[model samples]
Target: MDALSQALAKSRQTISAYEDYAERYDQIVRHVPNEREQASLKRLVAIAGTAGQILEVGSGAGYDADFLEALGVKVRRTDATKRFLELQAARGKHGELLDLLTDDLGGPYDAVLALAVLIHVPRDQIEQVLAKIAGSLRPGGAFLVSMRNGDGETDGNYHTVLWRRDDFAARIESAGLVLIRDDFNEGRNREEWNTFLAVRPA
Candidate 1:
Protein backbone atom coordinates (compact mmCIF):
# COMPACT_ATOMS: atom_id res chain seq x y z
CA MET A 1 0.00 0.00 0.00
CA ASP A 2 1.04 3.58 -0.56
CA ALA A 3 2.18 5.76 2.32
CA LEU A 4 -1.01 7.81 2.37
CA SER A 5 -3.16 4.68 2.21
CA GLN A 6 -1.22 3.14 5.06
CA ALA A 7 -1.72 6.25 7.13
CA LEU A 8 -5.43 6.17 6.45
CA ALA A 9 -5.71 2.55 7.50
CA LYS A 10 -4.03 3.45 10.77
CA SER A 11 -6.42 6.35 11.17
CA ARG A 12 -9.39 4.03 10.92
CA GLN A 13 -8.07 2.17 13.92
CA THR A 14 -7.82 5.47 15.77
CA ILE A 15 -11.46 6.22 14.94
CA SER A 16 -12.53 2.76 16.07
CA ALA A 17 -11.03 3.53 19.45
CA TYR A 18 -13.72 6.16 19.87
CA GLU A 19 -16.55 3.68 19.34
CA ASP A 20 -17.41 3.52 23.02
CA TYR A 21 -17.38 7.28 23.19
CA ALA A 22 -20.32 7.79 20.86
CA GLU A 23 -22.79 8.75 23.55
CA ARG A 24 -20.43 11.47 24.70
CA TYR A 25 -19.24 12.74 21.34
CA ASP A 26 -21.57 15.69 21.25
CA GLN A 27 -20.76 16.74 24.76
CA ILE A 28 -17.08 16.38 24.12
CA VAL A 29 -17.28 18.39 20.94
CA ARG A 30 -19.32 21.09 22.58
CA HIS A 31 -16.47 21.61 25.00
CA VAL A 32 -14.39 22.56 21.97
CA PRO A 33 -15.65 23.02 18.44
CA ASN A 34 -12.19 21.79 17.19
CA GLU A 35 -12.88 23.60 13.91
CA ARG A 36 -15.29 26.43 13.29
CA GLU A 37 -18.16 23.96 13.12
CA GLN A 38 -20.87 26.43 14.00
CA ALA A 39 -19.72 28.95 11.43
CA SER A 40 -19.38 26.27 8.82
CA LEU A 41 -22.89 25.09 9.56
CA LYS A 42 -24.28 28.56 9.10
CA ARG A 43 -22.49 28.89 5.77
CA LEU A 44 -23.69 25.48 4.65
CA VAL A 45 -27.26 26.30 5.52
CA ALA A 46 -27.07 29.55 3.60
CA ILE A 47 -25.55 27.89 0.55
CA ALA A 48 -28.15 25.14 0.72
CA GLY A 49 -30.79 27.86 0.63
CA THR A 50 -34.21 26.19 0.66
CA ALA A 51 -33.01 22.69 1.27
CA GLY A 52 -34.72 19.72 -0.28
CA GLN A 53 -32.99 16.41 0.41
CA ILE A 54 -29.67 16.88 2.18
CA LEU A 55 -27.02 14.26 2.87
CA GLU A 56 -24.62 14.52 5.80
CA VAL A 57 -21.54 12.36 5.69
CA GLY A 58 -19.67 11.46 8.86
CA SER A 59 -22.57 12.59 10.95
CA GLY A 60 -20.92 11.92 14.31
CA ALA A 61 -23.49 12.81 16.95
CA GLY A 62 -26.12 14.10 14.50
CA TYR A 63 -25.78 17.67 15.66
CA ASP A 64 -25.78 18.99 12.10
CA ALA A 65 -28.67 16.73 11.24
CA ASP A 66 -30.65 18.14 14.10
CA PHE A 67 -29.87 21.69 13.05
CA LEU A 68 -30.76 21.00 9.43
CA GLU A 69 -34.00 19.33 10.38
CA ALA A 70 -34.83 22.27 12.61
CA LEU A 71 -34.43 24.44 9.54
CA GLY A 72 -37.01 22.32 7.70
CA VAL A 73 -34.39 20.43 5.72
CA LYS A 74 -34.63 16.70 5.16
CA VAL A 75 -31.34 15.17 6.27
CA ARG A 76 -30.04 11.74 5.35
CA ARG A 77 -27.24 11.00 7.76
CA THR A 78 -24.38 8.53 7.30
CA ASP A 79 -21.23 7.62 9.13
CA ALA A 80 -18.38 5.14 8.82
CA THR A 81 -18.12 4.73 12.57
CA LYS A 82 -20.51 1.99 13.59
CA ARG A 83 -20.93 3.39 17.09
CA PHE A 84 -21.78 6.81 15.72
CA LEU A 85 -24.20 5.22 13.26
CA GLU A 86 -25.88 3.41 16.11
CA LEU A 87 -26.18 6.64 18.02
CA GLN A 88 -27.69 8.35 14.99
CA ALA A 89 -30.07 5.45 14.40
CA ALA A 90 -31.15 5.61 18.01
CA ARG A 91 -32.03 9.23 17.42
CA GLY A 92 -34.03 8.16 14.34
CA LYS A 93 -31.86 9.83 11.68
CA HIS A 94 -29.65 7.07 10.36
CA GLY A 95 -30.29 7.22 6.66
CA GLU A 96 -27.39 4.93 5.76
CA LEU A 97 -24.27 3.41 7.22
CA LEU A 98 -21.49 4.33 4.85
CA ASP A 99 -17.74 4.25 4.48
CA LEU A 100 -17.15 7.25 2.22
CA LEU A 101 -14.05 5.52 0.90
CA THR A 102 -15.93 2.39 -0.13
CA ASP A 103 -19.63 2.96 -0.22
CA ASP A 104 -21.68 3.53 -3.35
CA LEU A 105 -23.99 6.05 -1.72
CA GLY A 106 -26.27 6.93 -4.59
CA GLY A 107 -27.77 10.35 -4.36
CA PRO A 108 -29.34 13.15 -6.30
CA TYR A 109 -29.18 15.35 -3.27
CA ASP A 110 -29.72 19.07 -3.25
CA ALA A 111 -26.85 19.46 -0.81
CA VAL A 112 -24.17 17.30 0.81
CA LEU A 113 -22.59 18.31 4.10
CA ALA A 114 -19.32 16.65 5.01
CA LEU A 115 -18.20 18.49 8.07
CA ALA A 116 -14.77 17.56 9.40
CA VAL A 117 -15.07 14.20 7.69
CA LEU A 118 -12.75 14.43 4.72
CA ILE A 119 -9.78 15.08 6.98
CA HIS A 120 -9.79 11.40 7.86
CA VAL A 121 -9.28 10.41 4.24
CA PRO A 122 -5.73 9.98 2.98
CA ARG A 123 -4.43 12.91 0.96
CA ASP A 124 -4.10 10.87 -2.22
CA GLN A 125 -7.59 9.46 -1.85
CA ILE A 126 -9.31 12.77 -1.20
CA GLU A 127 -9.83 13.53 -4.86
CA GLN A 128 -11.51 10.19 -5.37
CA VAL A 129 -13.73 10.79 -2.40
CA LEU A 130 -14.64 14.23 -3.66
CA ALA A 131 -15.49 12.75 -7.04
CA LYS A 132 -17.74 10.23 -5.38
CA ILE A 133 -19.47 12.98 -3.48
CA ALA A 134 -19.82 15.04 -6.62
CA GLY A 135 -21.32 12.07 -8.42
CA SER A 136 -23.81 11.65 -5.60
CA LEU A 137 -25.20 15.11 -6.16
CA ARG A 138 -27.75 16.26 -8.69
CA PRO A 139 -26.69 18.70 -11.35
CA GLY A 140 -26.08 22.04 -9.68
CA GLY A 141 -26.24 20.46 -6.22
CA ALA A 142 -24.23 22.05 -3.43
CA PHE A 143 -21.35 20.40 -1.52
CA LEU A 144 -19.90 21.58 1.75
CA VAL A 145 -16.54 20.22 2.86
CA SER A 146 -14.30 21.22 5.75
CA MET A 147 -10.69 20.39 6.53
CA ARG A 148 -7.73 21.55 8.55
CA ASN A 149 -5.35 23.78 6.64
CA GLY A 150 -1.83 22.43 6.01
CA ASP A 151 0.07 19.68 4.26
CA GLY A 152 1.23 16.10 5.04
CA GLU A 153 -0.23 13.46 7.38
CA THR A 154 -0.91 14.05 11.01
CA ASP A 155 -0.21 11.18 13.41
CA GLY A 156 -3.33 9.04 13.01
CA ASN A 157 -4.24 9.82 16.62
CA TYR A 158 -6.50 12.75 15.74
CA HIS A 159 -8.18 11.40 12.58
CA THR A 160 -6.95 14.36 10.56
CA VAL A 161 -4.91 14.59 7.38
CA LEU A 162 -3.71 18.14 7.13
CA TRP A 163 -4.29 19.70 3.72
CA ARG A 164 -3.67 22.92 1.84
CA ARG A 165 -6.73 24.93 0.84
CA ASP A 166 -5.78 25.68 -2.74
CA ASP A 167 -4.78 22.08 -3.45
CA PHE A 168 -8.03 20.77 -2.01
CA ALA A 169 -10.06 23.23 -4.04
CA ALA A 170 -8.27 22.10 -7.18
CA ARG A 171 -9.21 18.53 -6.38
CA ILE A 172 -12.84 19.45 -5.87
CA GLU A 173 -12.90 21.31 -9.16
CA SER A 174 -11.32 18.35 -10.90
CA ALA A 175 -14.07 16.21 -9.42
CA GLY A 176 -16.63 18.26 -11.35
CA LEU A 177 -17.61 20.64 -8.60
CA VAL A 178 -17.32 24.37 -9.05
CA LEU A 179 -16.10 26.39 -6.12
CA ILE A 180 -18.63 28.87 -4.82
CA ARG A 181 -17.30 30.15 -1.53
CA ASP A 182 -14.38 29.45 0.77
CA ASP A 183 -13.90 30.75 4.28
CA PHE A 184 -11.63 30.42 7.26
CA ASN A 185 -12.62 31.03 10.83
CA GLU A 186 -11.03 30.85 14.24
CA GLY A 187 -13.07 29.63 17.15
CA ARG A 188 -12.72 28.56 20.76
CA ASN A 189 -9.10 29.30 21.56
CA ARG A 190 -8.18 30.24 18.03
CA GLU A 191 -8.64 26.86 16.44
CA GLU A 192 -8.60 27.44 12.69
CA TRP A 193 -10.43 25.55 9.96
CA ASN A 194 -11.50 25.95 6.34
CA THR A 195 -14.91 25.53 4.77
CA PHE A 196 -15.62 25.29 1.07
CA LEU A 197 -18.92 25.50 -0.74
CA ALA A 198 -19.09 24.07 -4.24
CA VAL A 199 -21.71 23.14 -6.77
CA ARG A 200 -21.74 20.30 -9.26
CA PRO A 201 -21.71 21.64 -12.78
CA ALA A 202 -24.93 21.08 -14.67
Candidate 2:
Protein backbone atom coordinates (compact mmCIF):
# COMPACT_ATOMS: atom_id res chain seq x y z
CA MET A 1 0.00 0.00 0.00
CA ASP A 2 0.99 3.58 -0.51
CA ALA A 3 2.11 5.64 2.48
CA LEU A 4 -1.14 7.58 2.81
CA SER A 5 -3.21 4.42 2.47
CA GLN A 6 -1.14 2.63 5.05
CA ALA A 7 -1.43 5.56 7.40
CA LEU A 8 -5.21 5.64 6.95
CA ALA A 9 -5.51 1.95 7.72
CA LYS A 10 -3.40 2.33 10.84
CA SER A 11 -5.48 5.33 11.89
CA ARG A 12 -8.66 3.26 11.57
CA GLN A 13 -7.21 0.44 13.64
CA THR A 14 -5.93 2.87 16.25
CA ILE A 15 -9.29 4.59 16.56
CA SER A 16 -10.99 1.24 17.07
CA ALA A 17 -8.56 0.29 19.79
CA TYR A 18 -9.01 3.65 21.47
CA GLU A 19 -12.77 3.22 21.28
CA ASP A 20 -12.46 0.00 23.22
CA TYR A 21 -10.26 1.70 25.77
CA ALA A 22 -12.34 4.85 26.09
CA GLU A 23 -13.88 4.19 29.46
CA ARG A 24 -10.53 3.44 31.03
CA TYR A 25 -8.52 6.11 29.21
CA ASP A 26 -8.62 8.77 31.90
CA GLN A 27 -8.20 6.24 34.66
CA ILE A 28 -5.13 4.77 33.00
CA VAL A 29 -3.49 8.13 32.36
CA ARG A 30 -0.88 9.39 34.82
CA HIS A 31 -2.44 11.38 37.62
CA VAL A 32 0.05 14.17 37.13
CA PRO A 33 -0.60 16.25 34.02
CA ASN A 34 2.16 16.75 31.53
CA GLU A 35 3.70 20.20 31.89
CA ARG A 36 3.31 20.88 28.21
CA GLU A 37 -0.38 20.01 28.34
CA GLN A 38 -0.91 22.29 31.30
CA ALA A 39 0.93 25.12 29.63
CA SER A 40 -1.00 24.82 26.38
CA LEU A 41 -4.31 24.66 28.19
CA LYS A 42 -3.50 27.76 30.17
CA ARG A 43 -2.58 29.72 27.06
CA LEU A 44 -5.64 28.56 25.14
CA VAL A 45 -8.07 29.35 27.93
CA ALA A 46 -6.49 32.71 28.48
CA ILE A 47 -7.00 33.54 24.85
CA ALA A 48 -10.58 32.22 24.84
CA GLY A 49 -11.69 34.25 27.87
CA THR A 50 -15.47 34.86 28.21
CA ALA A 51 -16.34 35.34 24.57
CA GLY A 52 -16.10 33.22 21.44
CA GLN A 53 -16.29 29.47 20.88
CA ILE A 54 -13.39 27.05 20.73
CA LEU A 55 -13.18 23.81 18.83
CA GLU A 56 -11.03 21.06 20.28
CA VAL A 57 -10.11 18.33 17.84
CA GLY A 58 -9.27 14.84 19.09
CA SER A 59 -10.99 15.49 22.38
CA GLY A 60 -9.90 12.08 23.66
CA ALA A 61 -11.09 11.88 27.28
CA GLY A 62 -12.24 15.56 27.17
CA TYR A 63 -9.76 16.59 29.85
CA ASP A 64 -8.88 19.82 28.05
CA ALA A 65 -12.52 20.52 27.34
CA ASP A 66 -13.29 20.23 31.05
CA PHE A 67 -10.51 22.60 31.96
CA LEU A 68 -11.51 25.14 29.29
CA GLU A 69 -15.17 25.04 30.28
CA ALA A 70 -14.30 25.49 33.94
CA LEU A 71 -12.34 28.55 32.89
CA GLY A 72 -15.44 29.85 30.99
CA VAL A 73 -14.46 29.08 27.41
CA LYS A 74 -17.23 27.75 25.22
CA VAL A 75 -15.77 24.56 23.78
CA ARG A 76 -16.99 22.06 21.26
CA ARG A 77 -15.28 18.71 21.74
CA THR A 78 -14.78 16.25 18.92
CA ASP A 79 -12.94 13.03 18.18
CA ALA A 80 -12.81 10.50 15.38
CA THR A 81 -13.51 7.65 17.80
CA LYS A 82 -17.15 6.93 18.62
CA ARG A 83 -16.59 5.46 22.06
CA PHE A 84 -14.52 8.43 23.07
CA LEU A 85 -17.36 10.70 22.01
CA GLU A 86 -19.71 8.50 24.00
CA LEU A 87 -17.51 8.87 27.05
CA GLN A 88 -17.67 12.62 26.71
CA ALA A 89 -21.43 12.42 26.33
CA ALA A 90 -21.62 10.32 29.49
CA ARG A 91 -20.07 13.21 31.31
CA GLY A 92 -23.14 15.30 30.34
CA LYS A 93 -21.23 16.96 27.54
CA HIS A 94 -21.76 16.11 23.87
CA GLY A 95 -19.02 15.58 21.32
CA GLU A 96 -18.95 15.17 17.57
CA LEU A 97 -17.18 12.64 15.38
CA LEU A 98 -14.60 14.53 13.39
CA ASP A 99 -12.23 13.10 10.80
CA LEU A 100 -9.64 15.78 10.21
CA LEU A 101 -8.93 14.70 6.66
CA THR A 102 -12.53 14.10 5.60
CA ASP A 103 -15.10 15.74 7.82
CA ASP A 104 -16.31 19.32 7.60
CA LEU A 105 -15.42 21.09 10.84
CA GLY A 106 -18.30 23.59 10.63
CA GLY A 107 -16.73 26.61 12.17
CA PRO A 108 -15.43 30.10 12.04
CA TYR A 109 -14.41 29.47 15.59
CA ASP A 110 -12.53 31.96 17.71
CA ALA A 111 -9.91 29.38 18.54
CA VAL A 112 -8.99 25.88 17.45
CA LEU A 113 -7.09 23.61 19.81
CA ALA A 114 -5.58 20.43 18.47
CA LEU A 115 -3.16 18.92 20.95
CA ALA A 116 -1.17 15.92 19.80
CA VAL A 117 -3.87 15.20 17.23
CA LEU A 118 -2.26 16.12 13.92
CA ILE A 119 0.60 13.76 14.70
CA HIS A 120 -1.64 11.02 13.33
CA VAL A 121 -2.21 12.73 9.96
CA PRO A 122 -0.16 11.28 7.11
CA ARG A 123 2.59 13.43 5.61
CA ASP A 124 1.13 13.69 2.13
CA GLN A 125 -2.18 14.98 3.48
CA ILE A 126 -0.83 17.19 6.24
CA GLU A 127 -0.87 20.41 4.23
CA GLN A 128 -4.45 19.93 3.09
CA VAL A 129 -5.56 19.16 6.63
CA LEU A 130 -3.80 22.23 7.93
CA ALA A 131 -5.50 24.38 5.32
CA LYS A 132 -8.85 22.94 6.25
CA ILE A 133 -8.20 23.80 9.90
CA ALA A 134 -7.12 27.33 9.09
CA GLY A 135 -10.21 27.84 6.97
CA SER A 136 -12.37 27.04 9.97
CA LEU A 137 -10.99 29.85 12.05
CA ARG A 138 -12.05 33.47 12.08
CA PRO A 139 -9.61 36.26 11.35
CA GLY A 140 -7.18 36.70 14.26
CA GLY A 141 -8.41 33.38 15.61
CA ALA A 142 -5.87 31.22 17.39
CA PHE A 143 -4.81 27.67 16.55
CA LEU A 144 -2.98 25.93 19.33
CA VAL A 145 -1.25 22.70 18.36
CA SER A 146 1.16 20.20 19.84
CA MET A 147 2.68 17.20 18.15
CA ARG A 148 5.54 14.75 18.59
CA ASN A 149 8.73 16.03 16.97
CA GLY A 150 11.02 13.67 15.11
CA ASP A 151 11.90 12.49 11.61
CA GLY A 152 9.99 10.05 9.37
CA GLU A 153 6.83 8.08 10.09
CA THR A 154 6.08 5.26 12.51
CA ASP A 155 3.20 2.83 12.77
CA GLY A 156 2.10 0.53 15.58
CA ASN A 157 -0.95 1.28 17.71
CA TYR A 158 -1.40 4.37 15.50
CA HIS A 159 0.34 6.16 12.65
CA THR A 160 2.66 9.03 13.51
CA VAL A 161 4.18 11.52 11.08
CA LEU A 162 7.25 12.94 12.75
CA TRP A 163 8.27 16.42 11.67
CA ARG A 164 11.22 18.76 11.79
CA ARG A 165 10.47 22.11 13.42
CA ASP A 166 11.20 24.31 10.40
CA ASP A 167 9.26 22.13 7.97
CA PHE A 168 6.28 22.14 10.32
CA ALA A 169 6.44 25.92 10.60
CA ALA A 170 6.57 26.22 6.83
CA ARG A 171 3.48 24.05 6.52
CA ILE A 172 1.59 26.24 8.98
CA GLU A 173 2.44 29.50 7.22
CA SER A 174 1.77 27.97 3.82
CA ALA A 175 -1.73 27.26 5.06
CA GLY A 176 -2.17 31.04 5.67
CA LEU A 177 -1.76 30.96 9.44
CA VAL A 178 1.01 33.09 10.87
CA LEU A 179 3.10 31.68 13.66
CA ILE A 180 2.79 33.44 17.03
CA ARG A 181 4.53 31.34 19.64
CA ASP A 182 6.72 28.28 19.17
CA ASP A 183 8.31 26.06 21.81
CA PHE A 184 9.49 22.52 22.43
CA ASN A 185 9.25 20.07 25.31
CA GLU A 186 11.75 17.29 25.95
CA GLY A 187 10.29 14.17 27.47
CA ARG A 188 11.35 10.72 28.60
CA ASN A 189 12.67 8.36 25.90
CA ARG A 190 13.47 11.13 23.43
CA GLU A 191 9.83 12.04 23.09
CA GLU A 192 10.34 15.67 22.19
CA TRP A 193 7.20 17.65 21.34
CA ASN A 194 6.68 20.81 19.29
CA THR A 195 4.06 23.29 20.39
CA PHE A 196 2.83 26.31 18.47
CA LEU A 197 0.25 29.05 18.63
CA ALA A 198 -0.65 30.26 15.15
CA VAL A 199 -3.30 32.71 14.06
CA ARG A 200 -5.21 33.79 11.00
CA PRO A 201 -4.45 37.42 10.24
CA ALA A 202 -7.10 39.84 11.38
Candidate 3:
Protein backbone atom coordinates (compact mmCIF):
# COMPACT_ATOMS: atom_id res chain seq x y z
CA MET A 1 0.00 0.00 0.00
CA ASP A 2 1.03 3.62 -0.50
CA ALA A 3 1.98 5.76 2.49
CA LEU A 4 -1.37 7.47 3.11
CA SER A 5 -3.25 4.28 2.48
CA GLN A 6 -1.03 2.45 4.91
CA ALA A 7 -1.57 5.15 7.48
CA LEU A 8 -5.34 4.99 7.07
CA ALA A 9 -5.31 1.22 7.31
CA LYS A 10 -3.37 1.41 10.53
CA SER A 11 -5.82 3.96 11.82
CA ARG A 12 -8.73 1.72 10.99
CA GLN A 13 -7.10 -1.14 12.85
CA THR A 14 -6.61 1.11 15.83
CA ILE A 15 -10.24 2.17 15.78
CA SER A 16 -11.38 -1.43 15.40
CA ALA A 17 -9.47 -2.32 18.52
CA TYR A 18 -12.10 -0.35 20.40
CA GLU A 19 -14.41 -3.26 19.78
CA ASP A 20 -12.74 -5.24 22.50
CA TYR A 21 -13.29 -2.53 25.05
CA ALA A 22 -16.34 -0.66 23.84
CA GLU A 23 -18.26 -0.82 27.12
CA ARG A 24 -15.26 0.09 29.22
CA TYR A 25 -14.37 2.86 26.81
CA ASP A 26 -17.85 4.33 27.20
CA GLN A 27 -17.80 4.10 30.97
CA ILE A 28 -14.39 5.72 31.31
CA VAL A 29 -14.94 8.53 28.81
CA ARG A 30 -18.37 9.43 30.16
CA HIS A 31 -17.19 10.89 33.46
CA VAL A 32 -14.38 13.17 32.33
CA PRO A 33 -15.89 16.64 32.21
CA ASN A 34 -14.25 19.71 30.77
CA GLU A 35 -15.64 23.14 31.39
CA ARG A 36 -14.18 24.39 28.14
CA GLU A 37 -15.62 21.54 26.14
CA GLN A 38 -18.98 21.95 27.81
CA ALA A 39 -19.01 25.63 27.01
CA SER A 40 -18.04 24.96 23.42
CA LEU A 41 -20.81 22.39 23.10
CA LYS A 42 -23.30 24.82 24.58
CA ARG A 43 -22.36 27.34 21.93
CA LEU A 44 -22.74 24.74 19.21
CA VAL A 45 -26.13 23.67 20.48
CA ALA A 46 -27.28 27.26 20.72
CA ILE A 47 -26.19 27.96 17.16
CA ALA A 48 -27.66 24.68 16.02
CA GLY A 49 -30.89 25.67 17.74
CA THR A 50 -33.16 23.42 19.80
CA ALA A 51 -34.52 21.39 16.94
CA GLY A 52 -32.93 20.37 13.68
CA GLN A 53 -31.30 17.47 11.89
CA ILE A 54 -27.80 17.06 13.22
CA LEU A 55 -25.08 14.68 12.12
CA GLU A 56 -22.31 13.67 14.51
CA VAL A 57 -19.31 12.55 12.52
CA GLY A 58 -17.67 10.30 15.07
CA SER A 59 -20.14 9.25 17.72
CA GLY A 60 -17.66 7.21 19.77
CA ALA A 61 -19.63 5.87 22.72
CA GLY A 62 -22.56 8.13 21.85
CA TYR A 63 -22.30 10.49 24.82
CA ASP A 64 -22.64 13.51 22.57
CA ALA A 65 -25.45 11.81 20.70
CA ASP A 66 -27.40 11.26 23.93
CA PHE A 67 -26.73 14.82 25.01
CA LEU A 68 -27.91 16.28 21.73
CA GLU A 69 -31.00 14.07 21.74
CA ALA A 70 -31.85 15.38 25.22
CA LEU A 71 -31.71 18.86 23.80
CA GLY A 72 -34.32 17.79 21.19
CA VAL A 73 -31.94 17.65 18.26
CA LYS A 74 -32.53 14.88 15.78
CA VAL A 75 -29.15 13.20 15.59
CA ARG A 76 -27.65 10.84 13.05
CA ARG A 77 -24.73 9.24 14.85
CA THR A 78 -21.84 7.65 12.98
CA ASP A 79 -18.67 5.99 14.17
CA ALA A 80 -15.83 4.48 12.27
CA THR A 81 -15.69 1.72 14.81
CA LYS A 82 -18.24 -1.03 14.44
CA ARG A 83 -18.32 -1.83 18.12
CA PHE A 84 -19.03 1.76 19.00
CA LEU A 85 -21.77 1.90 16.39
CA GLU A 86 -23.33 -1.27 17.81
CA LEU A 87 -23.20 0.15 21.30
CA GLN A 88 -24.94 3.28 20.10
CA ALA A 89 -27.60 1.24 18.33
CA ALA A 90 -28.19 -0.81 21.46
CA ARG A 91 -29.06 2.43 23.21
CA GLY A 92 -31.67 3.00 20.47
CA LYS A 93 -29.56 5.75 18.99
CA HIS A 94 -29.60 6.13 15.22
CA GLY A 95 -26.04 5.34 14.23
CA GLU A 96 -23.98 3.51 11.63
CA LEU A 97 -20.45 2.41 11.07
CA LEU A 98 -18.82 4.93 8.82
CA ASP A 99 -15.39 5.36 7.33
CA LEU A 100 -15.00 9.09 7.08
CA LEU A 101 -12.41 8.89 4.32
CA THR A 102 -14.55 6.63 2.20
CA ASP A 103 -18.20 6.74 3.21
CA ASP A 104 -20.94 8.90 1.77
CA LEU A 105 -22.23 11.13 4.57
CA GLY A 106 -25.85 11.25 3.52
CA GLY A 107 -27.28 14.55 4.57
CA PRO A 108 -28.19 18.12 3.95
CA TYR A 109 -28.15 18.46 7.69
CA ASP A 110 -29.00 21.55 9.69
CA ALA A 111 -25.77 21.10 11.65
CA VAL A 112 -22.76 18.82 11.86
CA LEU A 113 -20.88 18.31 15.10
CA ALA A 114 -17.45 16.72 14.82
CA LEU A 115 -15.88 17.08 18.21
CA ALA A 116 -12.42 15.57 18.51
CA VAL A 117 -12.95 13.67 15.28
CA LEU A 118 -11.16 15.47 12.45
CA ILE A 119 -7.90 15.24 14.35
CA HIS A 120 -7.79 11.66 13.15
CA VAL A 121 -7.86 12.70 9.52
CA PRO A 122 -4.53 13.04 7.73
CA ARG A 123 -3.35 16.60 7.30
CA ASP A 124 -3.38 16.47 3.52
CA GLN A 125 -6.90 15.03 3.54
CA ILE A 126 -8.49 17.27 6.15
CA GLU A 127 -9.57 19.93 3.68
CA GLN A 128 -11.20 17.40 1.40
CA VAL A 129 -12.98 15.92 4.40
CA LEU A 130 -14.19 19.37 5.36
CA ALA A 131 -15.46 19.92 1.83
CA LYS A 132 -17.40 16.68 2.01
CA ILE A 133 -18.82 17.86 5.30
CA ALA A 134 -19.79 21.13 3.68
CA GLY A 135 -21.57 19.23 0.96
CA SER A 136 -23.54 17.37 3.60
CA LEU A 137 -24.93 20.52 5.18
CA ARG A 138 -27.86 22.61 4.08
CA PRO A 139 -27.21 26.18 3.02
CA GLY A 140 -26.80 28.28 6.16
CA GLY A 141 -26.18 25.12 8.21
CA ALA A 142 -23.71 25.11 11.07
CA PHE A 143 -20.60 22.96 11.53
CA LEU A 144 -18.86 22.76 14.87
CA VAL A 145 -15.52 20.98 14.88
CA SER A 146 -12.93 20.66 17.62
CA MET A 147 -9.29 19.88 17.05
CA ARG A 148 -6.04 19.97 18.97
CA ASN A 149 -3.83 22.94 18.19
CA GLY A 150 -0.21 22.32 17.25
CA ASP A 151 1.57 21.01 14.17
CA GLY A 152 2.45 17.79 12.31
CA GLU A 153 0.99 14.30 12.34
CA THR A 154 1.35 11.43 14.80
CA ASP A 155 1.31 7.77 13.99
CA GLY A 156 0.70 4.86 16.29
CA ASN A 157 -2.20 2.45 16.42
CA TYR A 158 -4.17 5.38 14.94
CA HIS A 159 -2.99 8.53 13.19
CA THR A 160 -3.51 12.15 14.24
CA VAL A 161 -2.92 15.43 12.47
CA LEU A 162 -2.44 18.37 14.80
CA TRP A 163 -3.05 21.76 13.18
CA ARG A 164 -2.29 25.31 14.16
CA ARG A 165 -5.53 27.30 14.69
CA ASP A 166 -5.12 29.97 12.04
CA ASP A 167 -4.06 27.41 9.46
CA PHE A 168 -7.04 25.27 10.36
CA ALA A 169 -9.47 28.16 10.02
CA ALA A 170 -8.07 29.00 6.62
CA ARG A 171 -8.73 25.42 5.67
CA ILE A 172 -12.32 25.67 6.87
CA GLU A 173 -12.88 28.81 4.86
CA SER A 174 -11.37 27.19 1.79
CA ALA A 175 -13.98 24.49 2.04
CA GLY A 176 -16.72 27.05 1.25
CA LEU A 177 -17.73 27.66 4.84
CA VAL A 178 -17.79 31.01 6.60
CA LEU A 179 -16.20 31.31 9.98
CA ILE A 180 -18.76 32.39 12.55
CA ARG A 181 -17.28 31.75 15.99
CA ASP A 182 -13.86 30.59 17.10
CA ASP A 183 -12.65 29.64 20.56
CA PHE A 184 -9.42 28.23 21.88
CA ASN A 185 -8.84 26.50 25.20
CA GLU A 186 -6.14 24.68 27.10
CA GLY A 187 -7.31 21.17 26.50
CA ARG A 188 -6.37 17.95 28.26
CA ASN A 189 -2.75 16.81 28.03
CA ARG A 190 -1.76 20.46 28.00
CA GLU A 191 -2.67 20.81 24.34
CA GLU A 192 -4.51 23.81 22.97
CA TRP A 193 -7.88 23.01 21.46
CA ASN A 194 -9.67 24.99 18.78
CA THR A 195 -13.42 24.83 18.69
CA PHE A 196 -14.67 26.40 15.49
CA LEU A 197 -18.19 27.23 14.49
CA ALA A 198 -18.56 27.71 10.76
CA VAL A 199 -21.56 28.07 8.50
CA ARG A 200 -22.31 27.52 4.84
CA PRO A 201 -23.43 30.79 3.27
CA ALA A 202 -27.13 30.86 2.54
Candidate topping lDDT: 2
Worst 10 residues of 2 by lDDT: 28-37
Q: What is the C-alpha RMSD of each candidate to the true structure, in Å?
A: 3.0, 2.1, 2.1
Clash count, one per candidate: 0, 0, 0
Tens-digit per-residue lDDT, 25-92, candidate 1: 65666533334566666666666665578889888888777877777778888887788877767767
Tens-place lDDT digits, model 2, residues 69-157: 77788999999999888877887989988888778998999899998889988888889899999999988888999878889988777
Worst 10 residues of 3 by lDDT: 30-39
- lDDT tens digits by residue: candidate 3, 1-202: 7866865786676686667767887877754336666666666677677888889988888887777777787888888888888877787766877877888998899899998889888776787799999999988889999998998877765577899989999999999999988998885568888989999999
TM-score of 2: 0.90
Model 2 scores what on Cα lDDT?
Answer: 0.85
Off by over 4 Å in 1: 2-8, 31-51
Q: Quote each prediction's TM-score.
A: 0.85, 0.90, 0.89
TM-score of 3: 0.89
Compared with the true structure, all predictions reach lDDT values of 0.77, 0.85, 0.82
What global local distance difference test value does model 3 have?
Answer: 0.82
